[model samples]
Target chain A: MSGEVIRRARGAVAALVLVGLVVAPWVVDDYTTALLARTLALALVGVSVALLTGVAGMPTLGQTAPYAAGAYACAVVGSRVSDVGVVQLVVAAGAGALLAALIVPLVVHARGVIVLMITLAIGELVVVVLGRWRSVTGGTDGLAGVPAVRPFWGLPALASDQGRYLYALVVVATLVGAVLVLLRTRAGLVLRAGRDDETRLRASGHRVAVHLSGAHIAAGAIAGAAGSVLVVAQQYISPADFGFDTSALLLLGVVIGGTASVGGALVGAALVIAVRDWLFGVLPGHAPLVLGALFVATVYLLPTGVNRARSRLSEAAAPQPDPPAAQERATVGEVGR
Target chain B: MTAVAVGTNRIDPYLIPALDGVAYGLLVFVAASGLVLCFGVANILNLAHGLLYAIGGYTAAALLDGGWASLALALAVGVLAAAAAGVLLAGLLTPVATGSHLSQALLTFGVALAGGSLLVAGFGPDDPQVQVPATLEGSVMVAGHRYAAYRLVFIVVAAVLAAALYLVVRRTRAGMLVRAAVDDPEMVACLGVSPARIRAGVLAAAGALAGAAGVLGAPIIGPGTDTADTVLLLSLVVVVLGGLGSMAGTLLAALAIGEIQTLGVALLPAAAPFLLFAAMAAVLAARARGLAVRWRTA
Candidate 1:
């Protein structure tokens, strides 16, 4: 296909997704609508993971830090000030970005396992600080009493579950669209390039660290936004909400959905949240077993994740523009980078 | 090391804690040594390593009788069981043996999560206790402070194991082959040695070591829902700081971290958790590649 055709197709798909999201809350049951909202919020974190791990070629287990940062930011602001929902969300995002900036430089300096461990350590540090700063953070009890979110200037407070879900959908969809646009930019291209060959990208005079830092901060911001949405929707924020398990689950969602693709992240997040919720409803104590089995099976069965399946389906109708060999090379290049 | 004056005014209050830190660090070494070996030989950052450690602890908790004979029996069972679990895990991962580290990590993490829950299911939510033998249950006076005798035994056992591993890796033909395989698996295979078999062997040995640590260290650390996760995190820290696949590096890093943790707690309990992470960040920032050693030669 020609570049024009490909671009048009991509735009059409994005528009369709937006339409689907807009209509989803009305179509689904109340429980599912709430679930969808939670899924989208989680997917925002998945988006961050995809950008950092999938696109920028950095593996981080420390996203929970920014996650908690955003949650607490909104919780603190919302509790103190009344009904400035939009402002709270912005502050939450900024809080995430700020937290990311504090650690990304140190993390970016290291490579491979060193990077992995340092980010993980930073994440643990965030949890410790949150737990210890009881006077400020409310310690293990968590900060509560988050007011209803007024998502926009003209909009009334999102008091109903459906209203909150739609608000979350709007925020998540906008971020998703923004990420898609960002992917087309010079910085985004450099981020992907850095993942493929950092040394070459560096030799070619692209500031790899800067690109990486930007990606990290972007991920943090998205996660922060997600956290703020979660806080507003639940009207509660707790350290347990963004623990290691959440970080792990977010990474798993990114991988299961297909990293390096916005749609994949959304699908992965939705799947994770759905499965967890469904399993809890049906099989209360056995969710971990099933979840673990799913994780192993996903890795074994869909090595490249559900994105590969999506591409395969698309190929049946459209014949993928790139040859199999080129795609294979891309896969090889992307893994373990 | 015990030469510090006993009185409160004599020396650094942290000195005793630091010595205690040494004992704690040795236990860490015992748990992490296997993980480092697995990474060094097989290039697998086994996330289920903590599960194996837990398995060992639980085995001792469930099976061990009271006396010395039972203790020896328990150690043997724990090591063998862990070794078998390692072999099984490696078998499960054989298909993705040459795959990306991400998949390997995910698979192991899956095992940790699921296997951890299974342990709770089988053993109940309560943290399992492994009783120290009567002879080893008492405390010894050290610098006018009483310290658990089991800790000293742990130090001796870990030190001996460390020394033995050094000798084997440095002097033995099998160790040479293992090191060579790590550096260049294909080259070793070209010379008619099966790197896969060697990796399996190393993984089993690592599991056994982890099991031994779990059985012996259970009295101190114990097994619980979060034990595997916590131990996995700490062990990974030790491996990263020590340099992947380097035993001596693991030992040094473990000892240093042990002291930092114990002493940090002694000084400021609230900040203790952050101290290790802070130290790790500082180390990684200063030495971007980590304190990794040359694979084949080192």
Candidate 2:
């Protein structure tokens, strides 16, 4: 449709997300909201993942390395050294970014599946080192009993899971919102263009490798920050927290929900967590079989993801293109940089 | 006295141990074979392949620990059980293999997650170990020290299996079909072979290999969540280092990596991982494009 309508629709979606963030915790149980809080904390990684994979076409398997880095940094810093939330987050991001910077350059020139293989290998390396390095990581069982991170300006406590979920909710919301805005900016637009057509962008004189490197580090930073927040909320840090399984599950969530929109990450996260717990109770030996089957079906039926599929199906049924006026109105939508 | 004697005699510590690395290498080979088959043949980088290994360990542990009627039966059932699971996963993954690697990765990752959950639920997140069969236990002298007899058997069995695979792939009709299938499925189909059947058979074979490795190595690795991720990484390292669709490369790579891991640990216990990564990084950097090459023939 017209640019004005499209802009307005975007604004509406933003409003809906904001409203949902405020009201959602009031209704859902402590476990789900906490899980959602984890998802929100975790979604920041997805944002960077969407940036790199959805836009830049890099298949990275160890997004969780950064997440684990951030988590452990936050844990060690928050619990052992200090309780300041800001310091923890900064350390998480800084540590993650530093690690990503070191490794991403090594594989920056790789694309598609190779990037994933390298990252998955890195992920294993991170876990293995952490699991073995007893002095820093506390070894295999993980560090338990991290304090509830912080309340703003020396505020009073919400110590229970519900209260912690609410606190985490605010942090996750602000970060996710900031990222969503950042993705709407010039760098994001350029990355999307690079993803869609790297050669053409390179022909137009953009340093594609440099851009990919930036996205890789940025993703790690986001993941690291999420890990930091996770440590705060869980009040526990263990090798198990940032295990490869966590990375795989998050990636699985992205796959189930499809990657085009932020909502897909959310849906994927909720579906993944809920299914695991439910299956734990019900599925017995057939758990992998069922999950694998579900994933396979999702691929065949809605490869573009649920929302994309819905949009496509609806558009197919409606048989109407956006009005010329609408298309003409939002040149800003095309404006990336 | 033994340690002093061994140190004074100065027997070639490096060489025999290097040979000793062969047994460990063979174990990794059997373990990685299933993954190579799935990754190259089915074109699915199944994230949950390690979970299958872990499950195999658990299956062996449960049967052997739970007082199953026969140790041989437990091993057989454990391997078959894993193969059956593979067949089931093959059915699930066949449709999605055509999708983006991300989707395939996610599907498999989710399965891995669910697999972990199932493992925890069933085994209560505790470590489970399969008792070494009496026949497989005890040690044989290798590098001035007695090594596990089972490991020697492992080396022999894995070597035999690898030879059989080479023979099958090189000399047999099925090998010819698989080689041709890798090049072009459409062409293979036109040549009067069912691609689906071949794919299923390869996947099942992969599962069997993974299961056997899991059960056999359970005493060494144990039944745990670590099984999936570690084995998966090793498999990736093997197939990639060796180059896809090259059994020789897979074997050689598996041995090299196995040696790297063991020797690295032997030399530097705390810093083995970095050494591991450094080796891979050097290799990958040396041949930037010699990674996974999906051969598409017109």
Candidate 3:
């Protein structure tokens, strides 16, 4: 297919996804609606991870820091303002980006395990602070009494499961669109390069740190937005919600989904949630064991992610006429070594 | 007389916690030593290090119901089990040894999660505590203050273990090969030595050490669902803070962190939780890489 045709097809797929989300609430039952809302928010987090770890070549175990920041920001803002979901979400995203900015310098130059460890530490630090500052965060019990989400000032409050689910869907779809657009920009190209070869980028006189900072900030905003949606959907926020497990789960989702693709984030998120909820029902008490096994299997057998299987099938069916240079560029990019 | 009294008063407050801190520090070293060795020699940071520790702890706890000889046997069994786990992990990781550390870390993390779940399934949700043997269960006087004799014995045992480990790594032929592999695995392979075998050996040894620490130190922290995760986090911190592939650095950092943790808790309860992370952040801020190995692939 030609470039314009491929772009149009991509846009059509995105639009279909948005439409499906819009109608999903009415189609599914209340229970699934609530579940879908939570899953979408979590998938947004996977998108953020995909951006930083997959695209930017900086794997983080600390995406939860921005996530928790957004959650807390929403909770704090909700307590002051009666019903301002949109405003609260904006503030939360800004908070997440700000927090990421503060943390970038600490981890910017570190590589591999160092980056992972520092990010993990930053996550723990946030948890510790949230737990210690009881007066603000409500400590271990978490903050309660968050007002029902209002999409805007005049819209009806999202008190019902369907309302909240729709709210979450709209917010997540917008963020996903934003991320997809961002990933096609010059900054995204630089990030992809940085991930592939930082030394080369440095030699070329590109300040690698600037690109990294941009990726982190963008990731932070996405995660923060997810957090805000999550708080509104669940109507609660706690320190436990944004712990090591959540961070691990988010990273796992990205890896499982296809870190290089936006759709992979959504698929990965949906799969993880299904494993947690549906698999729990199927296996009774062995959900974690099953999930762990799945993770191992995914890493060992499907290193490129589940999406690779579909992409391969599609390629076999309808192979595009690719120019040799694109393949050469892909080989050169070699995003994650 | 007033000057002496004031000096004693000032020193008296921290003296006991400091001693306790030393014991805790020694245990941390024991737990982290194998991790450091594995990273140094194999260039693979095993996230399941904590699970190994917990395995040792659970085995020792389950077996400590018998007499003194049985207790010793239990410790040996725990160490062996952990070593076996190490071998299995090494076997699994060998295929992907050349991959990025992120993937390696994720794979090991999956192993940890599975192992942790299995532990919870076997032991239930309750924390498992090992009963200290009658001989080492008493209290000892330290400047007129009473302290757990078991903790003191633990400090001694760990110190002896540390010395033995240092000597073995520094003196033995096997240790020479291990060190050579750490420096350059390709060169060692060229010299007709299989670096993979050496790495597996180091991993087993490290696993044994972690197991020993788990069993011996389980009495202090106890074994539970969170045990593996907590230990993994701390060991990762120690590995990073001490710099990869540096045993001495690992030991010193562990001891200092142990003190900082204990003293921080005793002095300021509110700030205690953040102390380790705070220290780590400060170190990384001052030195971007902290203490880093020569060859790092992230």
Candidate 4:
């Protein structure tokens, strides 16, 4: 129950999850492998959601806009320009970053629920454009027959479900690792500070909006890269794939994972999306019903998130004189009041 | 002279869409007013507001049979049903009332998702047809363009509802209490009226408004799988654009949105989808400072 022991346990659990992911494609059936690949792509998007929602003090449902931009861009470039996964990823990331940059002005000043609403609108608008822009996007039918992607030059193109799953896993791990490293930097500290108290950060002469805008672009790039992986995994892209439901589910996944933890976001999002895909496969029309129930239960039971609950347990066992994290959480809870 | 003539010709084809915008805007106003009140007074962002509206839409679809009596029955049933749903939501929200907006959103969104699926399960997955009253089902000539009579009736109904709401909020003791609660819940609580009751009452009223909009607007928006999302998004846009609490601002924002959705689409079909959000982002970004101040104070 000590903090050190809790950290070690978390490390061990992460390693076990990684090992499981690495071996999953080989053990699972092709359908499950494909599903896992899709979940990986979505989980990566969840990391970006957490980056903004947890790290930067902005809860967004519009990451899908940049995600879709990255996806369609990757799909287009994959078909016409290159099939190399790296090239597609760069294009997708650039597309996503560009879209995020454009939207920075709209969201930078907004806080709390206003950001959520604005992002929700932005996300819906992207879907609308995707559904209507048939000439390039193929309308609601989405782009199909996206060429297979090679992980690198001279590498064989992904052909089987297992191959695609491994490709997605590797990409997700690399991007997630990058995000983890990035969050340990000064930029992350500033973002967390701003989240805790923007007024104090501003008084300290920090350009809070600039840091947020940077975080927004970085998250967009990450989501966009994930979109490329999604195209690679599914080999088809459509507006329905990035609908409001996807954004909502991703947000819930972040909440479940602990909004402030990147690893938690990854796992939580994957778990949520995986469950949804599985439920749809097994239960057909009742997926939303179950997922909705899960969301409500998550809110009620895991008010702070799965990660936070564990930390709280550890803290309770080894009580601290004054926990800054707990105090920060208290401030976060006061948002929108 | 030639340019002006071309402009007139161009505008001729969009007259109906322009009128449709007015009707659409009014519906959005009705739906969003409830959201404004809930957020403004109760400070609870009810994501299930759309579900409440859908309840009304489904009720209208189920009860209306193109008869006057059916219309009256649908309105009554829809309002009552949606009001009850709102009260249920208030009960559900009781625990999370003091939680962050995220928790409240998650809870309400869950209710919306669960309630939406339940409605679908009960009503079937397909978009159900809604029959309006026989007399109002027909089209009427307006400036030489034939328009749906049902849509025209929205203008009158919405205007009356808006005026009544304005009066109630401005003149009645309950209205003063609601305003006082928004400004200072502690002060309102000190006066002996439970803030919880006010919260529940506000949600119920909001639900009734949404239900009425849903039932009346059913012929246009319809009860379907996508209805809840569409209404929720539009109402959210209206509420945000209108700056949350002010009814007049909400009405204006709704009207602008209706025009953009209808007339803007007609004028620029190629750029139709990007129009609404683009305008929203532009307006919000332009007024960011004002909005931040307003949000802080609100």
Candidate 5:
């Protein structure tokens, strides 16, 4: 297929998915609607993971730190301060950004697996804090009965499951659209350039660290906003929601989605988390086993990712002097060493 | 006289935890050594290193029965079992030998998740009991404080193991080859030694070390659903803080971590949870800054 044709097809599919999501609550039961809302929140996190792992060349398992920060912040704000959705979201994003800013020094200079380990440590520490800080976070049990959120100041609070699901869907869509727009800007170009060749970008006087810090903070903000959506969707939040497993699964989902594609990340994360939730309901003890096996299979079957493999097939027809993908793989291999 | 006694009493409360820290630190060192070797020599992250440790832990839990013969048998079985698993991981990693760390991590993490659940299924979901030899199961007096004999045994065992590892790495021809490979794999390959075999050998040796640690440290850390994650996190912390490859650095980092977890927690209970990662982030950022400075000057 030609590039134009593939792009058109993808647009059509995305449109179909949007329409389907809009009507999903009506088609499915309340339980399924609630689950989809939760999935949407997680899928947004997946987008942030892609922003760091793919675009910024910093594969992180620590986005959850900001995510948890946003969540707990939203929960606290929603209960004591304001029950307004927009207010909670802004606070959550600020909270997430603040946490990301705090850890920027720890992660900004690291690359490859080193970034991963540091982020993993940060995420674990956040979870530990959440588990221990009983007065604020309600400890391991999490904050339950978070007040219902009004989408706007004058609007009625979301009461029904479908209402909450629709609210989450709108929030996710708006944020995802914002991210897509952000990526089209010069800032995104610099991030991609830095990811491909940091030394060259630095030599060009791009101020690579500043751009990376911006991207990191932005991703954190997006993840934090997702945390507010999560608070609205479930009306409960806990450290369990932001465990290492969630981060791992989100990273895997982003990979499956084609690491650099925001849309792919959303779909990929939703599918993975949905599968996990479904497996828990159906197989009980066998969720990790099946999901793990799927992860291993995905690595072998779609090494580049679902989106990249499809594009690579089309790009194969016109042979170039050098493929950037191959170069990327080589550089990644070197970085690992 | 009163002031002197008061000071002694204040210091006396922390004596056992300080001793416990040494034992815990040594166990972490033993477990983390395998990770250091895998990443340093083989260039494989081996995220499943914790699962390998858990294999030995489960073996110890199943086999040890509070007898000397049981202890010997458990060590043998644990070492063999974990080494076999390591060899299996080597086989699995062979295909991804030249892949990115992300791919390697995905594969190994998959194996860890699947393998961890399988172990849980086989061993049952609850934490399993581990039996130490009858003589070592009792407490030993140390600095006027009674400490668990099993934990005390770790100090001696770990010292002997560390010495053996040091000698092997510094003295043996195989160690020379391994170090040579790390410095320049292409040159080592040019010399006609099979790098693949060396990779396999390193993984097997790493597994044996982790297995032995698991079996011996089982009485302290125990076998449970969370054992793999806990051990993996600590080992990664040690590896990162130790500057990735140096054994002496790894040992010191592990000891620091051990004290922080035990003694630091005791000293500042409110800040206990933040101590380890705070220290790690601080050390890593400082090193990165130092490297940036060096790079600029050079």
Candidate 6:
């Protein structure tokens, strides 16, 4: 229960998750692999949300703006080229990051309800563009036929289903690892400080608004990157896919997974997707209502996250332990909120 | 969306219905009253406001089909339905959303989403139409064009409604409680009046207003997805611009927005939706001049 052990445990779990993504396609069926690709895409968005809500305390409800941006970015690019997935991904992520910067200035000064309303406005604006601007966006029909990230110079082919799944897994793993690294840096610590008490940190001599804005951009980039992968995998990007519902779903997943950890985001994505997918198969058309029920339950029962359930069960099952104050201290720090 | 040519010498068919947009605006005021009331009192953004609007439309449509004698009877049904829904939501969901707008946002957002989907599942996605009531069905020629007479009647009714609201809020004890709560919660709470019970009354009244708007307007405008969206956006613009609890501001802003929206679409068809956001942006930017948002726990 010591802080050092907890930190080490988290690092180990993250590493294990990374490895599992790499080896997953080999063990699971192609269907599950593809499902996992979807989960990874969602996890990427959830991670961005984690950064904003968990790291910066800015609970942005409408990430579908950048998620759709990333998807549309890829859609725009892949319509022109069949290769250079890296360039497409980079472009999508950059566009998402740019949008975050553009939208942040007016609302960054406000918190809580104002922040939510502005984000909701931004989302509505995006939906209108996607719906009304028919010429470029295909209107409600959505962008289709997005080619997968093709093989680059000297890289192995990503043409098969398994290959494509691995390709997605690799992208999420690398991106999540990058997010982890960014959070460990001074900027990350500052992001956390801003999340908890920006006023005090402002008093301690830091540009709080700037840090908050930077966090927004960073989180947006992560989401956009996820959207890039999603578009390529689904080979479609409709306005409905980027609606407020999807945004809410992303938020729900992040909350369910426990918003503070990269692993939590992934777990949230996995559980949410798995539950919906399974329930849909079992009950046919009753998924929406059931999913709504699940959302309410998750927020109530595992409010901190499903990890609390897991951690509690594990602790209960384990042998008795001596006091681990150091372990507790590290966890307290890592838990953020 | 070309502007209604002010200096026009020619008679156009669509031009007359355009003028009726004013009377239509007043009807919207009557309907939006409930939303403004609930929002001001509860600090709860009822995303399902449009659903109540839809319920009103459907109820009116049903009553009109069943050959109701007067608009009054149809309005009553719609109002009752909305009141019931308000009561249901207050009882079932308010506990979860008691103190956090985030939680309220999530719950109500879910309700709206599910409500929309459920309606889609139940009624299908096609726009629903109702026959205009017999008494107000015909048109009167004005400015060399014919405009629906019911629109004028709606304006008269709306004026009466607005007058009644002013009297009730200023003279009634419940109105006193609401004004007290809006101005200063501590004073309201200290006065030994139950803000919760008062909110329930305001919410019920608001729901009825939304329902009335829905039912009455559905025949004239038609009820569907677009109707719901327009109602939600218009309410937000009105509520925010009015500064939450200011009834006078709500009335002023609603009428102004109605003209702007009707005229904006008439004037610049291509930039229709942007004009809305333009107005919102203007209001939002002007927040620097002491446009303070007081957040009360929903």
Interface RMSD for every prediction, one decimal? 8.7, 10.4, 8.8, 6.9, 7.6, 10.7
Candidate 3 Cα misplacement greater than 4 A, ranges? A2-12, A305-337, B289-298
Candidate 4 regions with alpha-carbon error over 4 angstroms: A306-337, B1-10
Q: What is the DockQ of candidate 1?
A: 0.38
How many collisions between residues are there in candidate 6?
Answer: 12
What TM-score does prediction 2 earn?
Answer: 0.81
Global lDDT scores for all candidate models:
0.76, 0.69, 0.78, 0.85, 0.83, 0.68
TM-score of each: 0.88, 0.81, 0.90, 0.93, 0.93, 0.83
Give DockQ per model, in order: 0.38, 0.21, 0.36, 0.50, 0.42, 0.16
Please give the RMSD to the true structure for each candidate, in Å: 5.8, 7.7, 5.8, 4.6, 4.5, 7.9
What fraction of the true interface does each of the listed models get right, in terms of native contacts kept?
Answer: 0.31, 0.25, 0.33, 0.58, 0.38, 0.06
Q: How well is candidate 5 docked (DockQ)?
A: 0.42
Pairwise TM-score winner, candidates 1 and 5? 5
Best prediction by DockQ: 4
Q: What are the per-residue Cα lDDT tens digits for candidate 3 across B216-235?
A: 89888678887887787778
Candidate 3 interface RMS: 8.8
Q: Compared with the true structure, what per-residue lDDT tens digits does model 5 show for residues A126-203? A: 887898878889999999999999999999999999999999999999999999998999988998887766655767
Off by over 4 Å in 5: A306-337, B1-4, B291-298
Indicate the worst ten consecutive residues by lDDT in candidate 4 chain A: A312-321
The residue pairs in collision within model 5 are: none
Instruction: Compare candidates 1 and 4 on lDDT and give the better one.
Output: 4
lDDT of 4 by residue, A1-337 (tens): 6999999999999999999999988888999898889999999999999999888878888999999999999999999999999999999999999999999988887676667878987898789889988899999999999988998999998889999999999999999998888889898899888776565677789998899999999999999999999999999999999998899899889988888899889888988898888888888889889988988888888765633322222222111224464345443443223
**Best to worst by DockQ, what's the order?**
4, 5, 1, 3, 2, 6
Q: Which ten residues in a row have the lowest lDDT in candidate 3 chain B?
A: B289-298
Using lDDT, give the best candidate's number.
4
What would the TM-score be for candidate 6 when compared with the true structure? 0.83
